[model samples]
Target chain A: MGAGHAHTLHHVGDSPVHRLPAHVKIVAAFLMVIAVVATPREAFWVFGAHLALLVGIWVTARIPVAAIAARSLIEAPFVALAVLLPFFATGPRTEFLGLSLSVDGLLAGWNILVKGTLGVLISVTLGMTTPVRDLLAGLARLRVPGMVTTIATLMVRYLEVIAAEARRMRLARVARGHDPRFLWQIGPTVRGVGTLFLRSYERGERVHLAMLARGYTGSMPLLGVPTTGRRTWAVALAPAAAAVLFATAGYA
Target chain B: MTPSLEVEGLAFAYPDGHQALFGVDLRIEQGERVALLGPNGAGKTTLVLHLNGVHRAGAGTVRVGGLEVAKPHLQEIRRRVGVVFQDPDDQLFMPTVGDDVAFGPANFGVTEPELSLRVKQALGAVGMGEHADRSPMHLSGGQRRRVALATVLACDPEILVLDEPSSNLDPVARRELAEVLLGLDRTMLMVTHDLPYALQLCPRSVVIDEGVVVADGPTRDLLADPAFLAAHRLELPFGFSV
Candidate 1:
């Protein structure tokens, strides 16, 4: 799980999407989501147009459609909630395939589907383009609490180690003839989770001591010599502005 | 010059009923490289943890660079003593190699430009300057260890407390690590089971067994004493007795 998740989320590339400052991408994505959410449910054409814009961005960013689709499907279960809404909502009923469907339900379904799809697309795009470090940097730049970033940085770094430890424990259990298939076996699985938490907590303490030994005063030092020049800021803001404008029009 | 580390009657026990260390005493002079030899559960790690007050001195004093180990002076003591854990995974807890190295310096409040320079210098020392942007998870075990060293090196601590510096490393990588350690000029206290590595890298050897310091002398003499090693649950690898 660690290897696979780490591999999928982080890819090094020199594309424009990759080069843009993380803060810009985050703000742009948030705005795009807000735009999609605020758009009227009756505006199906606008949703179609927004989806096309996202697709264009993905194509230009050189991200594989299959990867995006696969990620999209991971969220499909939540999307199913919206898929079912059309059957229960109240409004003028319309006959479709000899079954009555409420107009309000149909609109509600469209609203959820469009907003959720756009939100997921924006997030997936950001994840595909930005490395986790830059994402944290972007958050830091945007005034995220230092403690939060520190925790996140530590979490991402040790996530693989923790996952590997979990895998080893699972393998050990399997070797001991413990198959976690039945409900009764779930108690042991939950205990395994508790053990993982304890191990992680202990590891965190040790790591903290190690950090203190290395002269860690409090704040994490910034690297890469950030140059907040007008050009860099301009480069970051251009796409964001364009995204906001497009989303605003869709809302209007 | 004052000793880089001076521990007298050091002892520690977990909050639970289990005791991990008994009375221990040791002294390592400045610029001296010493290897702490022990088996698993030999309290080598517990001793290392005391150098920077990580484990806290249960009943003794731990003085690093003339400062006593106490709550008020912890930050200053920590600044002087850098520790690298056995697991690189624990030490390098940042996304990119550069960021991980920069973490220590950043925590110490080094200015941005200086922090960048420190990061470059540390990574360069480990021959990993090119990997600064790369994620640590993608690196090999040896590379991860090197990066781990760089992370601590970035802080520029006067004393380095390394736990198992050569474990799980291939021969070439171990040789590379040895070369790197030899090149470093700081006072080093390395904990390891690798006898040859201890002999090659450190002039002094300190043996801890069952949480007590059993032997402390020149590496050659300690390794030469077969009975002393046997008494401490340590033995020369195979037929290669020292």
Candidate 2:
């Protein structure tokens, strides 16, 4: 249904990271993130090792350095919060660049910036490598309840369809001289969202009918399930194993 | 041993109490191709829904291969009646082309080797063998329509019900789709407004309006009748005639 779809974050390639079965990559990525999160924020070098660990995978995956950097900007808001932390926090004042800054605040800011950036990187790397459908399939393979995964998969599939419909409705609105750019015209835009909701609901009804026509019978039949073997898991988790070792060392 | 499809005294009304079909009867024998003609809101979709047991007959019967379309036999009826809905987007919901094609047979508990064979055969039949891994989103409208057809064709149904098979295709796509439809050997009930498509692909045509059958005859005879076309609001394209 949503086949052949590559979300914008996904960069299609045949790199080793892409070649790994989605479930294996999913497990490895999950473990890597958990290892990073478990490290003491005071263990500053450990965060760099985590960053380096991701970079190694990124290099292996053949994803562009620039693409990862571009999407990792999602952490910018948190970065801004970190920047404000040194100014507002009041513990253990110190001088830097002709201004007094709290010593504890700087460490706290560093923690947020470093951990948040690494977290975002992990997510971007995973998202860029695995298609959403494959990720969901991997979740299902991990024994997630079937109904939740099915609903999520359908939502992802219709996201594009609904977006296209909204775009068409926007064009129709503009063609009729409705200027959507004006701040004062927010009413129409908001109203348009409501209309889009109604349209999407109706389309969902029709899609349900179509599924039933083919014998949907209240549950989705599993298809194209991957048979991930032991070797694939071992290979994919190697970097994660390294990260966990570094995290353990940080606790020392 | 029985007709591929038999609809007799079939009637339906929505939960809103709006009657859409009134005592509709249709019979298509095995290997026959019939065009269902109707204006907007002619209850054509309602009829198609009943053929697969999606909607229960308000007052009559819809039989496929002599099996009644009821709760107990719905799965079998659905397997026997492959419905390609009016919109490809509405029908193609799986993650990839191959998965969508395999959806039907898999629903009937057909597994593994047999399922793959059906998916391969169906995609190959529709000239889409190479696109099995592609998403329906990446395909053009015509390609999507063909894949939608493959999704149902994989079931190897006795009768194929196509809703508006030629609605939004360019000329070449339109002709290509017609060729695919013509090549299929199963009984077909194509609900379409394209008069020439009916002429090119189906030998017989059935016209329904309001809530009942208005006319039924050969495609040429039905298209050639000026009064019948006008009476039913069925219009041929400009300068096109039988």
Candidate 3:
């Protein structure tokens, strides 16, 4: 009955961004990412503007810069890919600090770097401001297919339970002298996974029955449908709308 | 007035040819609290499932509030008969305790205003009104169990069927739950292996063994019969008496 351990990505706070309807925020985040993706890599100022917009959101949401940076490290692998692009791409050469580099490769690398970073940064902001359940409800409100939302909702609900079960099973195995460091112990570990899967499957069946016992028919009822008033859309989509303007101006 | 629950000639067998319940008959009056005592694999769960049509019996009839348990009546039957499964994780599958409590009623077309009110009332009944917005995963085991019960109670069921309600609860939680159950006015069928719990909460006890009702009497008398308890593979705590 205490305050739950909030997910690390979602810092609990009240702000205009956090107060916006989840569906509006979801749509705005989507549109902003699309705008960033469509912008030409050569439009360096537009990329800067987009970054500035995300930073504005972070500031408004009261999320710490260090927190955002730490969470954004999820893109490290993509960053590595972007870094490799200049070395591997074949194109017209250019001199940079007395070292030969491809002009086309540099542009491509910049494209990957700016666009991917913006995409991840936008997601981080969204995750930071909205809880997972609200995000799911937002998806439902956005008219995402019921099947997908239901699967996702169930997955989110049971993930911790299954993880806890796995942990308990591991402890039981360890108590019985099973050492995972040895190569031969892999067999038991794999079998344990299979057993966990079977248990999860059975639990799903039981849960389905429980759902039925509570009058669950085919469709899961929508508890609270989010309403995005015109004002909310205008306010929430201001940055995204600006991105579209920037892209168009760059194209013109 | 109709009986809260009536089961006659209820029989069931698994697909693997393992007969779980064979011609089990039981009845409970309105607002009665009955404890169903049984050993493992004694068909207690199977009989419980039949109450709400989760598992259809091959032969027999089940009636809740005068409504027969059948295809067309399933919705009404389920609404009137709320089942709290053995595992709270299975029952409270929604993200938040509030959402889970509102799930059943919402499914039955209970809209907001009333929906939120029902959720609040149910959570209040279980003494979990403060944890409405919290994730079920983050709750203690006892809290989760209470939330699971709230999920069913929100539907305003006339009959509450609980399977192993006290299995994993610590002593404090168990006593708290017993108090909560005692306070509720709805008819309750508590299936459990806890003899002391049964005596404490249910005045009458029914023992099911090997798909049959071996004994039906007062809980204290049933627990006192060592031969009957031994025959059904049930035991009370050491030095504990009714």
Candidate 4:
């Protein structure tokens, strides 16, 4: 949302993928994930096709391969879960390298690793191409629940302000000779959080009053009516449709 | 022609038994920019809130364009009275400057063509015509303040009530904002502790303290009264003259 500054996840570019409407991208990303999820775990080559499709998008969008790899580390916890499955999952056993491994467990592990990684990669690519503000706008255009979208929009707007306030309060606390690191010394830190909450709540009431002053009765009004047309959807959803075809064709 | 605003015996008390305004009365003509000067807790904000129906009239009546600010006319009253809040953060809550400015008019059912025109005209008035798509948070504090003003301006209200418009502004930003406020033609009721700002922007001034209008006169005469200022904790900056 920066005045000409692109967000970290969103690379500034005029690529065909980037120029596509945000709602179209949102729908496309969602369908890609759905196709990944719906694909059979045994279709290993189809999973490979999915990865190639995403990588093609990455190249077209001009996002660095390393950046995608780095950002995808957010799925490391799931990776850990996948790795542990073969050891902990109770199923039919098989011998491999002098260790009895559960065959079903190994298959389950591969399932999670491949499907989860593909899902996360598609999401990461989506994040890399679209600004967070536009993402929320797309959600609204897709007829997401009003309350959910409203709360999300506000939260995105205020997150930085609240973070900066927290930083200043922390500095002031330090200046006043308070160390919050010690377990026994967390009282002041906790109190600071409470103070921040109260301040934020009071600010919300003031903002609500400000909104009321400007003729806000109950619902929020739409600022931009998304004009994403049929052609844009057809073009944007092509890759997702291809992925779906790959999943359905049993390409493995 | 009717006065732009009329408030008579407007009284309000909090649920905790703290009375903020007790029988406050004021009148503003169609094009007068009046400074509502007061000490802290003097109910300046309370009175301004009543103008827009943010706070209901507990006792007396408030009318804008001869329309009472009662339940029946709340919407019309709000549409006619645009309040610029103290913190720009509170006012500019939308994603973009254009969106924020358009919020007020769109709520009153102003359709697209006119809405965009209003947004453009308002932003142009504030010298922010090119910032229609920019996020308010990305702009400098002064720019954000101007955008906040544009948000109210898009509504084209009969009266503009500003709360501490110059509170957090630097010297340059304050002067720039003062220039903008001085150029506007609407009736303005500005609540501020900035004495010099009151002198620069408003010709008429009213001092309200302890829930009452203590003094009402020309801005220069009121600021020059040392005893009157001291009684209300209103202090002009050092070496500053009227």
Error of 4 at B194 (Å): 1.1
Q: For candidate 4, write residues A46-96 as lDDT tens digits.
A: 989998999889888998888888878999999999988888889789988
**Which candidate leads in lDDT?**
3
- Output the number of the DockQ-best candidate: 4
Error of 3 at B190 (Å): 0.8
Error of 1 at A46 (Å): 3.7
Give me the TM-scores of chain B across the candidates: 0.96, 0.98, 0.98, 0.98
True-structure RMSD for candidate 4: 2.2
Ten contiguous residues with the weakest lDDT in model 3 chain B: B223-232
DockQ of each model vs. true complex: 0.56, 0.60, 0.73, 0.76
Q: Is the docking of candidate 2 incorrect, acceptable, medium or high quality?
A: medium
Classify candidate 1 by CAPRI docking class.
medium
TM-score of each model, in listed order: 0.86, 0.93, 0.96, 0.94
iRMS per model in Å: 3.1, 2.0, 1.8, 1.2
| Model 4, C-alpha of B111: deviation from truth (Å) | 3.2
Tell me the spans in candidate 1 whose CA falls farther than 4 Å from its real position: A1-5, A10-12, A52-56, A59-67, A173-197, A217-219, A229-252, B9-23, B38-42, B58-60, B209-214
